[model samples]
Target: MRDDEDLPFVAALYASVRAEELAATGLPEAQQRAFLDQQHRAQHAHYRAHYPTAEWLILEIGGTPIGRLYLDEWKREFRVVDISLVAASRGQGIGGAVLADIIAAAKAAGKGVSIHVEKHNPARRLYERLGFVLAEDKGVYDLMEWDMARPSDQGASEP
Candidate 1:
């Protein structure tokens, strides 16, 4: 991210990710915004502390910020620490395209890509379509993995 300059936009993106869940709480708009801001800070700190070497990138288009991708490379796998897109940019194949690039890169490196996805996340379908499989069930989150070593319905290295 662009540090302080992108703080507000990134926080807003984080809030958008939880907008539906927070809306269900019936909290007033201001309260929801405050809570989401706090949660976003916490998440940012957690990821920074845990994945100190991870690439924290801002997805941009025409010099405008649209999303963020946090990825960590390990010896055997690439961990998608988190990926979030602004509300307006979602459901338009941007995310899928980004993930396909990630998959392709991992395949080239002879490593697997893995992400922890919420069980009900709509993106899970996209991951599945791209050949990610359930590697583990961690309560609310499912760990999905894609490895070039495995046979994929989507031909290997087609990303």
Candidate 2:
């Protein structure tokens, strides 16, 4: 988000998200860390290339970095490239607040907001509760979307 100045924080954030999965592999600690570093670099490059204009943002609370958000605003849809928070920051309503803002902005622009969420991820419930309907199932992930036309109290600030 802050460019090179944020690389370390971004890498740490990526490592936090993969800690459980990497730990399950039972690999050596050093090897796991190296793997995560490589994967983070690869993902960073991929996103930059694929979504050249996407906004990379750092989510902070009280001046402490808690998460990262990547979004791409297109003519017809606002795409949520990624959103992740540290384990300690989960369930604190931060994600909901950010998502609500995106929904409201999308509604005001007459566009839809879309995100791809893992099928088993707990965040899917939050998206559903916020009026995002399952639009497609892509094996392990599902494409969810919310439009201004949907009848719901969500994105209430729209209009």
Candidate 3:
């Protein structure tokens, strides 16, 4: 976990799922390296962007941070702008369970919940099952949202 290479499992997950699409539009090897270098700096610079004004949660198993879910209100809905699990730890129901919990919480808060899933992401099925529909499609990713609770069953964000 010390070196970025330790994220091979995570990288592999992304690669195996979309290597062809990525290679077709992404940079060459050296340029990709430079891009990653720039991304490292940008991630640090925009750390706060990872957590918006809405409720955010860290997905952890046994106290280890495996992933994150950021929620922010927009147009009366709570949007999950980002979510990523360690490659080794994905597909074990963590993402789905966390998603369900977040949706439940959003319902109680009188806010709808949404997230963007890549076109080829395996998690897309989970979202669909959870009642998310295509709110928008940005070519690479789809904006999915759900308004589960009726007005009578909802209120405001919990303090």
Candidate 4:
């Protein structure tokens, strides 16, 4: 997604997810905005720093961008700051395909790619199918890693 066009959408998405949709759940507008604003600045800064040598990507289904993946190459090991597909697009293999593409792209760059999935998300299966393993936990998120060129992945391929 073009930052120019999707920044607002992305910002909204970030706000909604970070607040678990408090904006639409009768929470005060001011409080909702504050929660979202706090997350956006922190996440944006993290993305910028890690993205200096990496790639930022968005996945579209039809004409709508349904997912996003940010690969961090500024560090020795690659990492994904975020990966999300629209809720309505879930369970239709879009997440897998988008992540598969990200994996291929990161592997081509010769880095072990890692992603953090929220504890309550259901995408863990897709990640496991792609050979990503649990690396650690951050209270509310599970950090996972995938080494595409590793021996354990000798027979792995995008589904």
Best lDDT among the predictions, by candidate number? 2
List, in order, the clash count of every candidate structure: 0, 0, 0, 0
Residue 98 local lDDT, model 3: 73
lDDT digits (tens) for residues 1-159 of candidate 1? 635577778788898899999999999999999999999999889888899889888899899999999999999999999988887788888888888888888988999999999999888877888889999999999999998866356632222
Error of 3 at 35 (Å): 2.0
- Residues 1-159 of candidate 3: C-alpha lDDT, one tens digit per residue: 223433444343334344445467667976655555555456433534564465445567898767655566676777786666766567777777777777777887778888877888777777777777788988988888877642222222221
Misplaced by over 4 Å in model 4 are: 1-5, 19-29, 74-78, 105-111, 148-159
Better of 3 and 4 by TM-score: 4
Residue pairs with clashing backbones, model 2: none
Write down the lDDT that model 4 would get: 0.69
How far does residue 85 in candidate 1 sit from its true spot (Å)?
1.3
Candidate 4 residue-wise lDDT, 17-123, digit = tens: 55655645887878789877877878877777656655567667687877666666634456777776666666777666666666777777776778888787667
Candidate 3: clashing pairs of residues: none
Candidate that would win on TM-score: 1
Against the correct fold, how does model 1 do in TM-score?
0.91
In model 3, the runs with Cα more than 4 Å from the true position are 1-31, 40-56, 149-159
Each prediction's Cα lDDT score? Answer: 0.86, 0.87, 0.63, 0.69
> TM-score of every model?
0.91, 0.90, 0.65, 0.71
